[model samples]
Target chain A: MRLRLRPRDDSYYEMFTDSANNLVIAARLLVELMSDGADREAITEKMRACEHAGDDATHAIMRRLNKGSAPPINREDIYQLASNLDDVMDSMEAAVDLIGLYGLERLPKGIIDQIEVLERAAELTAEAMPRLRHLDDLTRYWIEINQLENQADRIYRKLLARLFSGEYDALTVLKLKDVIEELENAADAFEHVANTVETIVVKNG
Target chain B: MRLRLRPRDDSYYEMFTDSANNLVIAARLLVELMSDGADREAITEKMRACEHAGDDATHAIMRRLNKGSAPPINREDIYQLASNLDDVMDSMEAAVDLIGLYGLERLPKGIIDQIEVLERAAELTAEAMPRLRHLDDLTRYWIEINQLENQADRIYRKLLARLFSGEYDALTVLKLKDVIEELENAADAFEHVANTVETIVVKNG
Candidate 1:
């Protein structure tokens, strides 16, 4: 068997780690934004900053991937991973921004459950990024992310049922659904990142 | 410059074309579903089948990309293109399914504008996929798609403002927003697919 040489610059991995770290911050901010008596404007501004940071990190990775001859992992895997990570940040930012834009004073019931799932998923993703080099223990990261996504899904559906139950005004339901769906999208994006990592691992291993 | 050998199986391009064609049918169905006195169940069922066909096409392209030694385009581009195309289908399917699930009889105003944009975008995508091999005349395809997506975005924002204007009941706003947002997503997905194609063209040209 021919031996494959490792990539010269490991900066892509570092960039990924940076992006994943930003996601954790964004997810946490999302949780904070949902809490009572929170400053919606301040939290959303912070989340927007986090998203911008995530975008820069993703751009850095893409720049290196393009300038360099070969990536440490498959080039496509790097792109997909970076894009998905950015997507998670974007979704979080959108949710937070929607809450602020709608001027929602109160969050609907079941949102806390979704936020919990998001926080755990974000934390697990940050933990998994560093292990991309070896990828041996990364299976559990993705498996767990998949489970968290399912948990988020259940909570999302429950929240939807509540929204349509006539408890909230139509305008309120509209605002809350936008926020909840974005959170669900973030959860799904996290799963996409995990799945990308798994694909990279299988190819490399 | 070294000459690169083209891929042996061109089925991937054909598969993309098939998927894009399905989007056209779905878009047409969406327009049909929005018309008065329409059979919502039958139309949504048809769109769901189109989505499944799109999925199958995407899977076929991916299977070939994985199994084959090389693709006609960059492997990552191929994967992104396939995945984004599938995403457009998913978003369209979600919008249609929501209408059925919500049992919404009357759609909010400005929906028809969104559908028109989607229909044009879908047609343009169907026109663009086959040109992946030549990488010629694709710039306009992506550019037009971007414009169409912007159009869809404008319509979406207008619809949102209308939804929150107290014109509809709270439950009605909830249901209509879901449907409109999915259409907006489909428009975004089409732009993504177009952008991927443009990137592939730049790389391979």
Candidate 2:
């Protein structure tokens, strides 16, 4: 008797594909919000909007989990991955909200640079995501995503060190620390994506 | 054709399970450390040990992702969950580390109350975790775990409101906030567990 593998559902696969797309788009929006440098209120609104969209997508995935059969992989795993992606967006939005809410407009360049690193990480995550469905040739994307995540970690450490060592006023130090943490969180979310992608590739391949 | 759904051999699932257990144990230890009112250095060392254990578990899961088989979820979703779980631990550990590292000898009653909530949430999480392994009758565990998480959130809200109500000195306020956030973080970690368990139940049940 031959054991037949469960056929991968195209629609469920598509949901993940869309989730990856949303994350990439959210990352791009974050970068835009930074570069646009609009008024505080405007930036906050934009960030909030991005967060809302990301949340919708994440919730959609969760709702999907409840509404459909499990994907070829573990349902809990997918839910976790989706929630983490949403967290990245949530943290980004919160940073912007806190800045606007607390009137912290002047941020250090180093923190902004870390945000850039996060953007890059998000892009790498986006690139790695599609490969998960294929599970056949997963080496390149998985390795690159991990490399990007590690780079993000190194940047976080460097940023933290600079944050502590550099001379700044107490209030400035505090605000910058929060900003740096948010950026680090964004990177962490991306690293989660990389981690998940690698896991899928390894298990399925 | 009979479709056989074989369990994936990836080690991330096991690593995550171990991490879940470690987190619960850590919370219990933290409660002991706080209640014992040990010397600053002693409490710090114990907290560090818990943090180290959590870090090791995270590293193991990530390492498995990078080198072993792919995880059993959507790449994007897995990435998000793993990263968020790590963040929860990082934040919680930082809160405790700061306490000992900064020579905080006494925890306020309010903070202690919050820590109790966190400990309770962790306990609920540990209880819910084993259900994930067994696909049957898991929804009940998820529901109870989520209720515990919500209870923790309420404790956080009430505590934070009290903190900001002009009842404490500035330094005291800052430290209290840090501790509160950390306790809230442990609660957040359990929320993640609930989300994961719910998804698993959806899939298997």
Candidate 3:
């Protein structure tokens, strides 16, 4: 009888990539929501679905981790990466949901800048997730995510200054700041995901 | 010749307890800051120092983790617990700093409620940290912290409803919400720390 070891399952990487893709989808939807005359309800509903899908992907990864002998990378790294990606999705969903809950009809100028940073960060994250398998070419991914987070931080501070400058009514300033802060958090979450991946690479290398 | 294995260093548990004690001190200071006729500058300055001490404790734990062969628990669990404890301190410090930066003379009513829950949670956390060595009597600690977080979430939602009810002007609502959200995040961080402990207990049991 021929004996064969089970092939090392690599599906965790695929699931991580899927979650990253969901973040990209959510980020794009957010950008579209800020556009003129966009269908807010439909776009946000789709974003919600994307966030749900990300959660499902994370669950799948966890289930696999529980059953599998060991993952290619450290198990905790996988868990942290999954959780941080889920956080990015959660922050994006919260920002969109608050927009709807607060009945915000107009987009603030600073929001567009914030969304642009989120979109780029999400794109970079999606691009980086697959590299976990080989741990190659990841330095630029994390570095650029860090730079994007710094940019988002600057935009966030400037947005707050503008909000409090009395250019807009108090209510308007409050609502816009809520949304902007979530976007900033989403950017931070992206940086956190990148940091986790960097840690995994360093440990595994 | 006699062979002896290096004794397992258990100082990480002590450092964790120290960090949790720092959280309790910060939380108490936060409660004091919300009191009438409180010295905002001095109280927040002291809170800043508490946060710095928590950072130092966390750094010590990390330094030990890096050099030590192994911990009683999983290395990643140790890292997660320490990091989450540090995050609780960070959120509290951020809330206090923002309160100072906004230069608000008076706090909203809900802040006191939030601070009380934080104080209780911090106390519970301090009580729980030492149990990390034995993994005994941890279930009640985490369960109570989870309940406290739920209580905090209820208060937070009610607080938001009040903020938007037009009792206060838009700017005050803006400032208060920023502080309130950080408090909520602190509560969430506490829950996260508890959850990490629960995971460790389950794994080690």
RMSD of each: 8.8, 11.1, 8.7
lDDT of 2 by residue, A17-71 (tens): 5656555565655566566455556556655566656656666666667767557
TM-score for candidate 1 (chain B): 0.93
Residues B1-205 of candidate 2 have per-residue lDDT tens digits of 1111212345455655566666666666567766664555665566667667777766666666676466665444445445655665676678878786556666666766667766776666656544544555656666676677657765665665565455665577678778778777777776775675565456545
The lDDT per prediction is: 0.80, 0.63, 0.84
Which 10 consecutive positions of candidate 1 chain A have the poorest summed lDDT? A1-10
Candidate 1 ranges with C-alpha deviation above 4 Å: A1-10, A66-68, A143-147, A150-166, A169-171, B1-131, B134-158, B170-175, B195-205
Instruction: Judge candidate 1 against the unseen true structure and give its global Cα lDDT, from 0 to 1.
Output: 0.80
* Ten-residue stretch with the least lDDT total in model 3 chain A: A1-10
- Give model 1's DockQ, 2 decimals: 0.19
**Per-prediction TM-score to the true structure, in the order listed:** 0.67, 0.60, 0.67
Best by DockQ: 2
| DockQ per model, Cα | 0.19, 0.21, 0.16
State the displacement of the C-alpha of residue B61, model 2, in Å, after optimal TM-score superposition. Answer: 23
lDDT of each residue in B98-186, candidate 3, tens digit only: 99899878777888999999999999999988888887788789779978987997688678867877788877887888899999999
Worst 10 residues of 2 chain A by lDDT: A1-10
DockQ of 2: 0.21
